[model samples]
Target: MAEAAGCPLSVIVPALDEAAGIAATLEPLQVWRERGAEVLVVDGGSGDGTPEAAAPGADRVLGGARGRAPQMNAGAAAAGGRVLLFLHADTRPPEDGDRALLTALEGGRHWGRFDVRLTGASRLTLLGLVGAMMNLRSRLTGIATGDQALFVTRAAFRAVGGFPEQPLMEDIALSRLLKKHCGRPACLRERALTSSRRWEDRGILRTIGLMWALRLRYWLGADPAVLAARYHRG
Candidate 1:
């Protein structure tokens, strides 16, 4: 498919059994179209009708490989846009997110991510604290996660050899590669709203603690397979 004129940005959402939430996630892309952005949905062998759910809102929907990293790579390959956004199926971009991405792209920022926030009230305060910590950490270390809704120029993505086809920590791997290529990565003011399902399932405090431990282990060179087996959902 062709890209939008002037500003070429393609948002890719990877889905796996996301029929219930895919539409909500894609709704904001309708606004993005007005700001000269294209939306592509990559389905990871979803048993549910996720493709149909995203078809109406997305500019294109392509069947993807099983894993998220591979699926995102496939989506990026199909995309004709100069800027590629890697978004999760349970995340929603801010109202001005599209404009912010284009502005960053124009400003020579090859790689960046939006701030992240979680939905729901059970752990609102805790989640806010976590969000603040994440922002601070990104500023200090130049690491960005998938949940934050990362975006990068197609050239930069290709330079880093695209995302690794791993079952876990692919976001961290890509973020490190991006940081190596582009120092002091940009951070957009727009926030991506993410689902709190994991927090609810694992309990907020426990989940947060586990994430911190995982990060520490990763930093210490622990095997990602072990961490993935311990923390991965579904």
Candidate 2:
């Protein structure tokens, strides 16, 4: 059970080879933990000292299978909080993110997600439209992306069987299960700011095309492992 105003939240960051920004990504949690939030950095075999970088600020740096779904599942298993938040390593939660999460949980919903903002000044300027579109579309469809900072009650997460342990689309996949079992997720007002490294590294237009193609293929029942191959290759 949770309080009317706030509840203990466990923030799970699934990381992989993210040494460059892993420390910075987790540093905010020092304050969060003080405020009753627990932070876990679930790393999936990074060669670049990502786990070491996260150790300074994270409540726990846990190793797991090399994939976001499995890693996040591992984090959820070790969580001690009432609510479990799955955060991407490259995304930063909003100020007072724990409060935002607690607020979301009180609204007669088992799960919810924050909107997202892409970071980097120029990148934000260029991708602002894309981010806005994603937020609007996600709200309408009730399918949240991982960068959006999806959260669910521990009971609800277990009820839905956690993430699918697939190679890709786990966030959307989880949303689908929640939709069937729990109804539409509460869409929060606060937004998580995520680095635009994926779009920047691959060129925005090209990455956009690749994402659409991959999604289309996945919708057409293409194997996730095959789609993940194309995604990683791109």
Top candidate, metric TM-score: 2
The CA root-mean-square deviation of candidate 1, after full C-alpha superposition on the true structure, stands at 2.1
Give, for candidate 2, the lowest lDDT window spanning 10 residues. 1-10
Q: Note the residue pairs that clash in candidate 1.
A: none
TM-scores, all candidates, are 0.93, 0.94
Residue 186, model 2: Cα distance from true site in angstroms? 1.2
After best superposition, candidate 1 residue 94: deviation in angstroms?
Answer: 1.0
- lDDT at 155, model 2: 90
lDDT by residue (61-101, candidate 1, tens digit) is 99988889999999998888889999999999988887787
Off by over 4 Å in 2: 1-7, 121-124
Assess the local accuracy of residue 132 in candidate 2 as a C-alpha lDDT between 0 and 100: 86
CA lDDT for candidate 2 = 0.87
Q: Lowest lDDT 10-mer window, candidate 1?
A: 120-129
Could you give candidate 2's per-residue lDDT for residues 142-184 as a string of tens digits? Answer: 8888989999988999999999999999998999999889999
